[model samples]
Each structure stands twice: as structure tokens, then as C-alpha cells.
Target: MIAGLFETHLKVADLKRSEHFYGEVLGLELAHRDETRPITFYWLGGRGEAMLGLWEEAPENIQRQHFAFRSTVPEVLRAPAWLRERGLTPRNFLNDGTDQPMVFAWTPAIAIYFTDPDGHSLEFIAMLGGGPRPELGVISLEEWQSKL
Candidate 1:
């Protein structure tokens, strides 16, 4: 029987910088790290949930990755400004290179997008009420919530 997800490993150009971003800036707990061998692991929430390991490597060989963390409605709402204060630009999931957090009608989740130091697209999402998937375009969380 399937239990749950364990962790994910990602390659980063600089372990120290990535460590600071994932740890201090993002507020994830550093579960384990080894600067000598140059690999670091962090927990999404304390020692539970799941862990993420950042491995040092050359930038050219490191293909960017994307992932989303589950969050609550209030947290998702406050994320854009909070992330911006830390020097990260939050964008919409459209990858349009613009800062526009959105709400999807299909699965009904509020998602805020941003790129990490490694240029990996990341997202924070909160599940809301649902409906049939729209053909295209996303709406603001305020607009999505107001309709209900």
C-alpha cells in the first residue's frame, strides 16, 4: 500500500546560497547539511511533511525544476508580499514573467509562482471550492472567492 511522499533531490549551483534561501528566506528548517561534501537537506515543516535536498553542481548541467507546497487560504493570500519582501518576485503559473498570483476554477486552488536562485519555478497553493475546469485564463483569489 502507498503511504506518502518521502523527499525530492534537486541540483543547485551554490549550496551555501541555496541553503540561505531555502532556510532563512523561505523559513524551511534545515534538517541536515554538510558543507564540506556540499549537500544540504531541508524540511518543509519542522522534521515532518517531506524533505528537500539541494545538491551542488555546475549551473550548465542543472536543469531547473518546479514544485508546489500546500498552504492555507490566508497564507496563500499573504505570500506574494511576504515573498517580495525577501527579494523574490512571485508570478502567475502562466510563466508569463509577470507577478500575478491566480486562482484556478477547476481544482479550485490559489497559486503563487516564483523562481528560485537556480531559476526553478516554485509555487504555493491552497485548495478552495471547486468547479469544472475553465477553458483558459485564471482569476484573482478575491474574484474567485467573491463569486461563491
Candidate 2:
């Protein structure tokens, strides 16, 4: 039986840099480090909920990937400033110079996007309490709330 996403892996140009970003910056708990390989694992939600792996690789061999972390509405609302404080630029889905979270009307979820040091797209997302509103398309938090 399938439960949910257990783990995901990404190739990083520098393992130690990615480790500090995911572990120290994001506060993910360290799961393991393989001395035999240039790889490290960090627990996402907890020790067993989900895991993320970062493998060291040459810049030429690395490919950027996108992933999102589950979060609450309140947290997503505050994420822009928090990210800015850390020198990270929070962006909307369109990334058209807007640094506010946007709601995907189709999924009715709010999300803020950013990138890690290695330029891997990352997001913090939270599902909203409503039926789908695909017709509304993606809109800013203020617009979404005005409709509510």
C-alpha cells in the first residue's frame, strides 16, 4: 500500500553548503552521513515522516530541482519577511518582481517560493479551506482574501 512521499534526493555542487542550508538554516534534523559517499540525509518533518538527501557532485553534473515544504497559512504569510531577513528573495509563482505569496486557485493553496544557495527552487505551501477556484487563476494573498 502506498502511503506518501518518503524521501527525495537532489544533487548539490557542494555537500557541506547544502547540508548547512537544509540542516542548520531550515532546521531539518540530520539523519545520516555516508562517509563512503559524498551524500547526506536530513529528516523533513521528523525522523521518519519524510527525508531529503543531498549528494555532492560537480557543477557540470548538477541539475536544479524544485520541492515544497508543508506549512500553515500563518507561517506562509510571514515567510516573505523571514526569507528576506535571511537574504533570500521570496517570490510568487510568476516571479514578476513580486515578493508575496500567491494562491493557486486550482488547488486553493498559498505558497511562497525561493531558492537555495545552489539555485534549487523551494517553496513553503499551505492548503486553503475551500473548493477549487480555477477560474480565479493564481492571485496574490490580498486578492484571495478579498474574495473570501
Candidate 3:
């Protein structure tokens, strides 16, 4: 049985730009940079915890993708402002202008969405300690807490 995700790859429009975003902006640790290939790697949580690979490709060849980083509830609460301070816009799951994390009633997880330079969707998510409430649908953290 699979324990957890170990790695994921994304096609980036520019390797250098993606490197700065992941290494400097997001603060992931640099693992390796291949000189023979237009690719770079970073450690997600800690060294050897998880890995993310960015492969440089032409814009036409790059397909947008989505992925989420495991995060804590407190960090998720602060994500919107943290992202804004870094010159990024934090968005809800629906991305309808609201800049707050939402709780998915089904999984009851909190998550905030954002995009990378190449428009690849990214997320910071944390699971909540509760049973699923699918009927309540996706709602704001405040609304989710009020029902608790």
C-alpha cells in the first residue's frame, strides 16, 4: 500500500523563474539542478520528505497543472496575507474574488488556492479534525466553525 506522495513534476515555462518561486518565494529547499537538462528540483517539506521537479519547456508545450502542499490550519489561516505580502493573490477554491481559505465540507479540509508564474494552480491545504458534512457544501472557515 502507498504511504504518501513522494514526488510530482510540472512543466514550467522558465526554469529560473520557477526556481526563484519555489526556492526563494515559497522557501522550498534546493535539492538539485541538472545542467544537462532544463530541470530543477526542490524539497517540499524537509529534506527527503517530498520532492517537486520543474522541467523547462516551451510555452506551447507547457500544460497547466494543479497541486497542493500539506500545511497546518494556523498557516492556512495566515496564507492569504502571507501570499499577498509576497506579491501573490490568494484565492478561495471558487476564486470568485474572495481572498480567504475555505473548508471543503466533504473532506472538511481548509485550503487556499493560488497560481504560479506560469499559471499552474497551487494550493496550501490542511485537514480538519471532524467528520464529513457534505450537505453543508463548501463554506468559509467562520461558517464551518459556527456549525461545530
Instruction: Please list the C-alpha lDDT of all candidates, in the order they appear.
Output: 0.84, 0.92, 0.94
Considering TM-score, where higher is better, how would the candidates rank from best to worst?
A: 3, 2, 1
- Model 1 TM-score is 0.87
Model 2 backbone overlap count: 0
State the RMSD for candidate 3: 0.7
lDDT score, candidate 3: 0.94
Per-residue lDDT of candidate 3, residues 1-148 (tens digit):
9999999999999899999999899989999999999999899899989999999999999889999999999999999999999999999998899988999999989999999999999999999988989999999998999998
For residues 100-125, what per-residue lDDT tens digits would candidate 1 score against the true structure?
A: 66888777788998888999888999
Candidate with the larger lDDT of 2 and 3: 3
Q: Candidate 3: deviation at residue 101, Å?
A: 0.6
Q: RMSD of model 2, in Å? A: 1.0
Which scores greater on TM-score, model 1 or model 3?
Answer: 3
Q: Which residue runs of candidate 3 sit more than 4 Å off their true CA positions? A: none
In candidate 3, the residue pairs with backbone N, CA or C atoms under 3 Å apart (3 or more residues apart, or in different chains) clash, namely none
Native-vs-model 1 lDDT? 0.84
lDDT (0-100) at residue 94 of candidate 2?
Answer: 94
